[model samples]
Target: MNKGLTAKGRATRQRIVVATALLTREKGAAETTLDDVRAATATSKSQLFHYFPEGRSDILTAVAEYEAGQVLDVQQPFLGDLSTWESWQKWRQAVLDHYIELGQRCPLGSLTTELGKSSAEARAILTTLFTEWEEALFLGVRTLTSAEPEAARIRARSILAAIQGGVVMLQATGVTDYLTAALMTSTDPLRPTAEGTD
Candidate 1:
């Protein structure tokens, strides 16, 4: 169970998280200071501590989780239901469009990399995000074929790897070619075999 918090408290906390995320995205986590977050959020030092008692680390973890959610939220209806070929295509386009818009900046990746050095919690947050993402892909894969659960699980993991690889390349080159090829090749198996074709 969670502790009860007033509406205002929740709003304040959300404001802080949103402000912090924005700052981190723009300035990179290593350069963002508590004072920066406080000023941007219009929060006092004590108020910041009231929400994040562990200080900068705690706030960074919250921002990491928020960014993780954004990764999935952008996928939307397509990600939730990839049972059909059309759905898969839509999901791929959504992913490509998102990265294209984001260019080389990956908020979650930057946050985790910056905070992961000293915070086990930051690593755990990233692990949880990847786990959930893989599970979602697994479920979607199962819908496409009668393959065994293990096989579907493997395929899902490969798909995730492809996406990550693409993102990494995008970060390095500021190009979408790798990501586009990754999504296409990874989803190729999901397409139904044409009549009498293996």
Candidate 2:
């Protein structure tokens, strides 16, 4: 969408996206409207169209991309390394803490449902996010466990699934137990054995 624009124009576009993201997080993507975005960003309809020619879908696609980055950002440092059990634990805690605090306000669920049918472009963005997330976890698993590559990959996918599932439950029930337990179970294998085996 940012094919050609001055730095100031890019900044203005980004400002709109960020504001829309905040509104989505607070009110949900399904509930959020172009009017809400306009009010939040103080942008007129023409300005919004100039920045996002496709209107709400385009802005939402951008926000989905941005929120996808945030999903990985919260698990950073530990997510980057995870070469040791300690680092994995730290990463686990970071994931747990983020979702627990977010509770029902988390936007992933709403984004998926809202964009799944609206546009292939939006769906692809989310697909990329999950792929990137799984690859990061797979790298960590490979580094920390001497298991076969395929096994490590499966483990990483399972862990990622656990997180997504737990978050779904957390959003529905407003309870952290589901997420907490899910992380513990999914990460248990990554912990070193008492015999110091990894």
Candidate 3:
């Protein structure tokens, strides 16, 4: 009985968090209101306060964590296990398609920016997301080579950096070409050896 109630409580809290993340993504962090969340989640003000006593900033942090998870969720199994060329291609397209569809409307980027780059909490969350994301990419690169673990890791970092930089440019220019170019350049260093090329 206690466990059931705890589960229900957790579900309710998650509902609030997800509702806040979606609304903030669509409306921007600064523009989002507790009333808006209350309305969207069909949660009462008292319930909202009970779940998040600190108000907006507390909820914003939870939303940040949620959005951070989603930023790479689209890549899925392919992102986690890139042992084949086909899987790598799938991961690449998933990333490209995601940003392309997102266009200039980037909820995750907006949330992080609003949170401020200098905030230690925000920076730590972003850093953890990037490291986890890079590990996935590194796994794919390692699958392509056996003798260069360190080199593959470094190359993977470069690819990740390029993609991030490209996303920033995409936000500004509404173009995916930069992202495409960056992915290409990052993968270039991983081409099969001359003997295997043929």
- The lDDT per prediction is 0.80, 0.83, 0.75
Q: lDDT: which is higher, 1 or 2?
A: 2
| Residue 31 in candidate 3, Cα distance off native in Å | 3.4
Q: Which predicted model would earn the best lDDT?
A: 2
My TM-score estimates for the predictions, one after another, are 0.87, 0.92, 0.80
Residues 1-198, candidate 3: write the lDDT tens digits: 114447778889889998887776567777889899999999998888777777777777777777778887877977988766666777788888888888766654554565435245656777788889888888787776553889878888998889877887876687889988998787665555422633
Displacement of the residue 160 alpha carbon in candidate 2, Å: 0.3
Q: Candidate 3 — which pairs collide?
A: none
RMSD of 1: 2.7
lDDT of 2 by residue, 1-198 (tens): 777988999999999998998887677777889999999999999999999998988988888888777888888988888788888888899888888888887766555655444578878888998898899889888877777899988999999889888888887789989989988999997775412863
User: What would the per-residue lDDT of candidate 1 be over residues 85-189, giving only the tens digit for each residue?
Assistant: 778888989998898888777654464455444377777877887898898899888876756899999999999999888887776688989989998999888
Estimate candidate 2's alpha-carbon lDDT, on a 0 to 1 scale.
0.83
Those runs of model 3 whose alpha carbons end farther than 4 Å from true positions after fitting are 1-5, 115-119, 193-198
> lDDT (0-100) at residue 189 of candidate 3?
57
Q: In model 3, where is the ten-residue run with the lowest total lDDT?
A: 189-198
